[model samples]
Target: MKEEIQQQISDALGQLFDAVSKLQLAYPGKPFTPDGRLVGDIGEVIASLNYRITLNEGLTKHHDAVADDGRLVQIKTTFSDHLTFPVHHVPDYYIGIRLQADGSFEEIYNGPGQLIFDQLVNRKPTRTGLHGGLMSMLKRINKDVPDAERIPQR
Candidate 1:
């Protein structure tokens, strides 16, 4: 079973590599990073598959997906870093996914947009950006929004 899963992952990665290569060829001067927009796309795809939601992709402004009941969802994904919620076009809820070094992902927070925005507003400003880690943000979200769900690593 593990071998089968590994094979599937390998096949998927191969296809992704091919697609990226073609994209790189198509746009010669544009720079690309694996952790850039690819991470965001992966996050949206995962959220859509796991929750059975429909992704808006480029069709919408800020929100990435539409929930089963028609609520707007804004997905944020990070690999070993904190999320940076955009100031404009905030959605109804935010889905935060963290990609682990072991190739697994954890849904750190899923709740109302206000909870995330409130935390961002209260955080101290840093030279680069907001001064807070994922844990700190999660703590505030959990405290302020009691019904927020944190999915286990899978």
Candidate 2:
């Protein structure tokens, strides 16, 4: 990502956290952390910027973006320690990232979709169809991927 866009994302996330903080202060025990579609959307935007992928418009199924090499990519983002594969179709590529409190992010996995899919093993499918794996486990799996197999960052 460009330095300018990185700073912009940081600023926006700061504003969001501030607003959530105020909401929590008023509500006391209530939680206000951003998750679900918001985090997913942010991840998709960041992935597009960093990887130079073209995002598929209007909630296309299976994959979010397509790379310059014509590979369909599945981008997964989370605030927690897990990344979930909810789609049954394994994408051509997979990029997993975790959002931090300071608006920064950590890339968990970036490689062929089947590599991650193969690790699912005997995991039972959820009602939401999400098959989750720990970030640590994903990192270990990522180590086996040669750089040549990964989508290059812009």
Best model per TM-score: 2
What TM-score would you give candidate 1 relative to the actual structure?
0.64
> Which residue runs of candidate 2 sit more than 4 Å off their true CA positions?
none
* Candidate 1 residue-wise lDDT, 37-123, digit = tens: 777776776666566468884747778887776777888787656676665434587787776433356767777777677667755
- The TM-score that candidate 2 achieves is 0.91
lDDT of each candidate versus the true structure: 0.65, 0.84
Q: Could you tell me the lDDT of residue 11 within candidate 1?
A: 69
TM-score of each: 0.64, 0.91
- Candidate 2, residue 29: CA error in Å? 1.7
Put down candidate 2 lDDT per residue, 1-154, tens digits, no spaces. 3778878888998899899999999998988878899999988888877886899997988999988988888899998887887646777889999987566788898999888778775677678778765688789988898998888888
- Model 1: weakest 10-residue lDDT segment is 145-154
Error of 1 at 44 (Å): 0.8
